[model samples]
Target: MRRLLWPAAVLVLLLALNVFFTPSFLAIQVRDGHLYGSLIDILRFGAPLILVALGMTLVIATGGIDLSVGSVVAISGALACLRISEDAGVLAAVAPALGLCLLLGAWNGFLVAGVGIQPIIATLILMVAGRGLAQLITGGQIITVNDEAYKMIGGGYWLTVPFGVLIVLAVLAITAFLTRRLALGMLIESVGGNAEASRLAGIRSRGIIVMVYAFAALCAGVAGLMISSNVSSADGNNAGLWIELDAILAVVIGGTSLAGGRFSLAGTVLGALIIQTLTTTVYSIGVPPETTLLFKALVVTAVCLIQSPSFRAKVFRRRGGTAPPAAVAEEKARVREEVPPDGVRS
Candidate 1:
């Protein structure tokens, strides 16, 4: 909970800033039996990112990175859209897409776990090549489909809320159950903390690695479906472009170390919300298009610094009051050294 404070606070501040700009930023209304508001829009549109980051949280927890997730997103969306365009059932399109993503992830795991390639290099290979795969699937053209059932997955409403949000919730719940209620989370952490030690302790670190990579790819697959379904088209070149970076950033913001170990699904969710809200704030405040990325960078940097304990200590030290524990202890030791044996000031 403490770890989540900075991200939660930052999210709140961003939302408050938007209220200043849009005046009605917090106003949520139901129109024609559908909920509508800026906040609702953030949750709906950010659902895909939340899903991606959720998978990222697990992968990073296992001390690996999956650069290919963005490409997987493109490929998944392309293949699913292509199948649907061919008059395939929505189930047929989705199952195959997700299965392929799972295989792609397993391939990456094989390269890293089986072939002993560094994770970065292994995933990078797929990152570059998967785009071509997606292009091939879509024949270098956007595949547009008109399936109402498919659209419901990403853009439709359920119980007055975005169905995408519900999907995210379901995925999050399942992930939490798998990681928290079971032994899977601990095994992953152990593997990440020290692969050799875990192996010596009889944990199948290799299998865990494979499973997490596959899971990450699976999450990206779902995100791809959501993105393409929302738009009713899949662009091999543009679908989920650069989303991996955002997912990594969200994991970091959520207090997950890239070095791998402990993870918090709730924190990751909050981090994703913060990022989406930041995007909303930028658009609401009329930030110039060219400066948008730079603006986001600055804000993110501030939030990260606030979340860093060492950075906070440095700030406190420089403030000339409320010295950090180490500084206070040092000062006390110095005073004791200078004082006389009678406990009086020199």
Candidate 2:
């Protein structure tokens, strides 16, 4: 919880800025029995990112990365939309798409865990190959579907709340239970902390690594479905372009170590919300559309620096005109050694 303070503060600051720009930014009203507000929009649109980051958090905790998630997102949506366009039922289309995502995930896991490939390189292979695979599935075209049932997953409302938001909540709860309630979280952390030691301790580190990658892909797959379903189309070339970057950013912002070990799901969700809110802020504040990415990059960089403990320690030391504790202790020891028995300086 202490680790989350900085991120939470930053998110609040961003939201406050939005409130200043748009007075009604935080206002929520029920319209036709449906809740509507900027905050709601953020949650609805950011749902996919939240899911992707959740999976990335787990994989990162296990000392592995999955660069193929963006590609998996593209492939999942493309396959689902393509099947739907062929007059298949929504369930039929979604099931196969998710299954393929699982297979792709397992294949990535196999490469990294079984064949001993580096996680980045192993996933990167699929990252590049999967795009072509998605294009092939779509015949180099955007597949659009008119299935109302499918739309409900991403865009439709239920009980005055976005269904996508509900999905995120459900997924979050399940992930929490699996990792926290069960022994899975400890196992993942042990492997991440020291893979060789974990293996020696009979933890089956390889299997855990494979499982995390598979889980990451599964989350990406669900995100893909939500995106395509909301838009009612899947552009193989652009469905989930660069989403992995955002997911990684969210995980880092949420206080997850890229080096792997401990993770915080709540922090990841907050991080994702911060990012989505930042995007919304850009538009509301009237920043130039062309410069939006640059603006976002600058803010994110500042947030990261603020969250860095080393950076803060240096800043505080400079402001307080004090050296670090180690330096001060060393100086004290040197002075003590130099002093004579009379308790005076040499």
* Backbone clash tally (model 1): 0
Residue range with the least summed lDDT across 10 consecutive positions in model 1:
329-338
Error of 1 at 273 (Å): 0.8
Over 130-244, each residue of candidate 1 has an lDDT whose tens digit, in order, gives 9999999999998889999999999999999999999999999999999999999999988877788789999999999999999999999999999999999999998989999
Candidate 2 TM-score, C-alpha based: 0.92
Which residue pairs in candidate 2 have backbone atoms (N, alpha carbon, C) closer than 3 angstroms, thus clashing? Answer: none
What do the candidate models score in CA lDDT, each in turn? 0.90, 0.91
Global local distance difference test of model 1: 0.90
Query: In model 1, what is the error at residue 19, expressed in angstroms?
Result: 0.8
Residue lDDT tens for model 2, 1-346: 6678889999999999999989999999999888999999999999999999999999899878889899999999999999999999999999999999999998988998899999999999999999999999999998888999999999999999999999999999999999999999999988877788789999999999888999999999999999999999998899889999999999999988787777899999999999999999999999999999999999999998887766665776898876567545544643454454678531
- For model 2 the local lDDT of residue 230 reads 95
Displacement of the residue 206 alpha carbon in candidate 1, Å: 0.5
